[model samples]
Target: MSEPEAKRIKMADGTKAPVIGTHNGHFHADEALAVYLLRLLPQYANSSLIRTRDAEVLKTCDIVCDVGGVHDHDAKRYDHHQREFNAVFPGSATKLSSAGLVWMHYGKDIIASVTGLATSDANNDLLYNKLYADFIEAFDANDNGIPIYDPAALRSAGIEKRFSDKGFSMAGVVNRFNYAATEPRNAAKASVSADAPAAPKQKTQEEEDTRFQKASHFVGEQFVAELLDKAGSWLPAREVVKQAFADRAQYDAQGRIIVIPWKPEGVPWMEHLYNLEEENGAKGAVLYALFAESGEPDSKWRIRAVSLEPGSFENRKGLPEAWRGVRDEELSKVSGIPGAIFVHASGFIGGNASFDGALQMAKQSVDM
Candidate 1:
């Protein structure tokens, strides 16, 4: 016989909402995040969530996730517990969980929606890949119990043990909602409940449901906040950085250093520079970035070293060694540049009291 078709729930407002079902009792980050991503899409924005393990209830859900016995995307069933099931994204070695599965299918559309970018926009792919590498992959690896490295290999390499403690991760945070003893051990001992038929358990299924609801909300809030930041703040800064890079020749004759004008706040510009570099095949062309201090007086400008890669501290070219740790008049005398403020001891950044002096410092450092 053919399987029974799933049903949709009708809201009080007379609008129909798809029912999303997951297992009850205990929840995890994977399902929490998966549900959040699903709800972000227009099709599921007003969907109702049903938390239960009953086969009848699950069968009535328009879509089942994390708790379903099968993993069939076309059927709208997403679960990874089956013995023969092992699915990984293209070009990835780690197996996917419910969260990853959801992402693998709808990630591009979700990112475009969240970032307010058209699905055809070039940066959508960039942001999607970056987020997966930095955030979603961890959820997939954690859910599948995949270690960063093989424990036996590490042991053979003289690493005694692996640190499995990850108490701050999203998964770790969701696990906190699991049941714990309501009464203190000392209090329970004092009560002595052996004769009283286990003192009718105070915590109920209602409470578990409440906690699951709260956790799902929390995960959804975090997901929205992160994507908003990437879309609103991080992505827009790319154009500003690109324009500054294109105008590098106006700032310096060699076009080796890009100067960014003052802004009220700092922006993430380095990644954009790297992306531009990769596009132009001009890797290592620009060695330094000079920009005005965000909130500082007009006299102040900051010069920063350009790193070989995003987030890496190692710079393509550091400031002159002689200028390291020097300040004020001494720095001016050593570098032979007027308005020299200070150069950091580590040589990653330096300051000047004037824009010309900052540009001069950058040029001189490049020559050195």
Candidate 2:
């Protein structure tokens, strides 16, 4: 289907399509993302976009964003420009831009639309919170000019960045779509005498609108990609780790050893394991995770030591000291376990040829 037709709803009364309004001229990432996010819903997917600063023109819009000077969800006006506006997403101190405000209201519905999950589903809530923390919060902070790091702390520690990373974010990409701020001055200098004042040459509404659409699509596609990754890959791994943590007793009475049937590449289990431990009211409980090595020709299994904290290199418990840096027949003889492959010098991980041998290694470690 053609793009315009896909975005137009058939009106029974023959009225014009619902209009989503924002200010015209140079655009920023916040309103661009806000418009794209609104378009994801069934009601607004077919809506028309109108960019203007005229109050009368804005009043004609069904929903206005980033220029209305007011935020009223019931009135469908989301703007963060007012003097008293200090609105933020619940539990977050970073100020909301029009993007965060729209997300604060319609984010769950957007997630449900994209992932085919009910808004009330626990998994939907999980994705909603996770996406905001991982993806959306950055837009909010960037648009509001909030720095991610403490400047004073960096100075106090005498820390300096080794490389420049400016303009490397999605927000930076969106900013590049804006009409050049220097174009007007350059045009006036070339076409008119310097002695006389010259009005700046401005892009027509249609030209600016085209750039806005491009910017919106760019940010929107990125948002969807992040959402899909969380739903398709991350959530499944969360379930796997949750179930394994719950079923840990079957592998050992201490409930310190969990078994994973298999591990998928780029799918994490440690973060989930730590969260599950806290949820189960037993922090730092699990010490080891056993899993079959995925797609290996020799049917190898591995036992990994769980860190004392998430993202920490320090393990809660390591494998036997005697087995560290040992391999093959020597490892088998040292550990008295069959089919042993090897153990890292750090003892954070070890390998075996069978699930039984892996489980036996974990149980022996638990005993030690």
Candidate 3:
């Protein structure tokens, strides 16, 4: 099918709004999130949302997602359940759900708008990729019924079991809204089945619409919360981390360690540092970072090893070998730093009772 021309709805105030349509009866996280993402754009900020499966009703909407039979991006029909449909995002093994499909096409613009970062900003791309890896990928994988681990491979490797189950994820929360007193909680389970027909409804159409609205509102709040953290908290820290990286030479003559101003909490420092090094063509030049704790005494500081990647335990440069598995006065004695508190046995990080002690620990690790 060819792409349809965009349609706009005129609000009561005479303002134009996009009309977004999805299936009715039951809602899931993928569709809820997809709708929320569309509204994040300025063009759709006050869009009218319609919940229905009526072919004629969906035809009147500007974009029909997760319900229409077609999966054409140009046509703005984003369903994935057709037997012949086997679409996946470029470079991704998992099939795309409505949420993933929307994100793949519009995530950069949505993230840029939410974070107040210009489309051309370097961090815009970084945040977009990070959000997908950490947040959106699980939605796509779960909707596609991809297993977290291959059970056969695990048994062959002598692994006894996977440690954790999928807990109360966002998808689970959305499904809960469909619950009604007449039906068992499991009734919502059908929402996850790509080809399962919608379960018979126990509630009136008015009641079902109310529940869908609640689910959409809940999902919208979640989207906003995550966006605020990424923008207000994380984006600001990138600047601090970048500056410390650029000034590493002043912190230590060898330019191996960076000392950032105190921060209230940890951010994506490792990722920012790694990206900065790549951009400057000085990969692996930074080894450690020292920063004071906000609202703590000036004597307290944290000395952290720069990880090779975010969420990785491996470090570009670990603490001195002698300091490993040492603590308190003993650590102080061996390290020749009086205020040394402890070094994690894993060598990822350590604590010191004074700024000078932490600085010495990071510098000595670099020298070692």
Candidate 4:
């Protein structure tokens, strides 16, 4: 028997074609942009952008979209920006979702400085696309830098009905709300709370020292914990390096104790992809860091400092000469200590709000 032919539907106008809205290539285009940026900067370990979320792309795309300025076509450069230094992001001070945050504390000129990629002839659309493409190099979800559109967070803030009423899809307007609305006041208090003590126009040097000491100790702990959590099977070593920093008495004279765990053999940790294997036969993956750092997988990396093995050296090239990864490079640039930290007033971690806490709490002054 012959099979029935397919039934085709046509537009009301009888144009004999499908009626479909234009697929907003915004999200897909954003993803493409992100992937492009990540692919270019393979030199920086932090450039390992990994998130594929639509909302993230939208948010990042939004930021890059707004960037533009004067350019000198003759020089073939956008402008003289401290591109090298900004490329070396000294840890961010603003919350990630606060797209306006960059403009609030940082200037648009700064974006041009590091990007050196976005040009004067380029408009917002082109600049945004270029920035998005550059961003995908390392989109760590856990990093506050990664734009996390939590629908639940929106729901908590009465955003579900708001979004529904506005006729915008969750994907379109997800990153446009204030998640932590109560933080600005809290940060103010931390800076100028004088209810119980003698008031001063500015925080005394002693207060400054106290803040750094506590925050750095907290940072070191968090780093080690994060590493162990990422390491799959390795545990932090019970032994810690016993030494005190000469600057202040933040830690003990014997030293701030740091523990190193046993690192496994032949594991894959190239470009934020950590594949661990036990000496015995244990096999499985562990945590996925929002933003984990890694060197070139193809290039042999010297273990400059392991979470458990401090001051340890390894020869990635094989014998005699030993070279190690610089674990503290980024953090040291931001805070004096290679791995120092700043905690938020609220105890929670891994959110942009908490990152602002770092900015407010860090004893160091904001240079930019």
lDDT of each: 0.81, 0.86, 0.79, 0.25
Best candidate per lDDT, number? 2
Candidate 2 vs candidate 4, lDDT winner: 2
Each model's backbone clash number = 0, 0, 0, 27
Clashing pairs in model 2, backbone N/Cα/C closer than 3 A: none
lDDT against true structure, model 2: 0.86
TM-score of every candidate relative to the true structure: 0.83, 0.86, 0.78, 0.18
Tens digit of lDDT per residue, candidate 3, span 1-368? 11122445567888666788888877788888888888888777877777888898789888878998788878888897788877776667878888888988888899877877877887787677767766777778877788678878988999884554334677777787888443554665555555665756567776776777777788778777877787777778889888888788987887898887876666567777887889999888888888776656765788989887777878888898889899999999999988999998988899998888898898788888
Q: For model 3, how big is the CA root-mean-square deviation?
A: 6.7
Poorest 10 consecutive residues of model 3 by lDDT?
1-10
Off by over 4 Å in 3: 1-10, 14-18, 83-91, 112-115, 158-167, 180-201, 252-254, 265-268, 278-285, 294-297, 307-309, 312-317, 324-332, 338-341, 344-347
Please say which candidate is ahead in TM-score: 1 or 2.
Answer: 2
User: How much lDDT does candidate 1 score?
Assistant: 0.81
Lowest lDDT sum, 10 consecutive residues, model 2, at 1-10
Give model 4's TM-score versus the native structure.
Answer: 0.18
Q: In model 2, how large is the Cα lDDT of residue 115?
A: 91
Model 4 C-alpha RMSD to native: 26.2
At residue 218, give the lDDT of candidate 4.
36
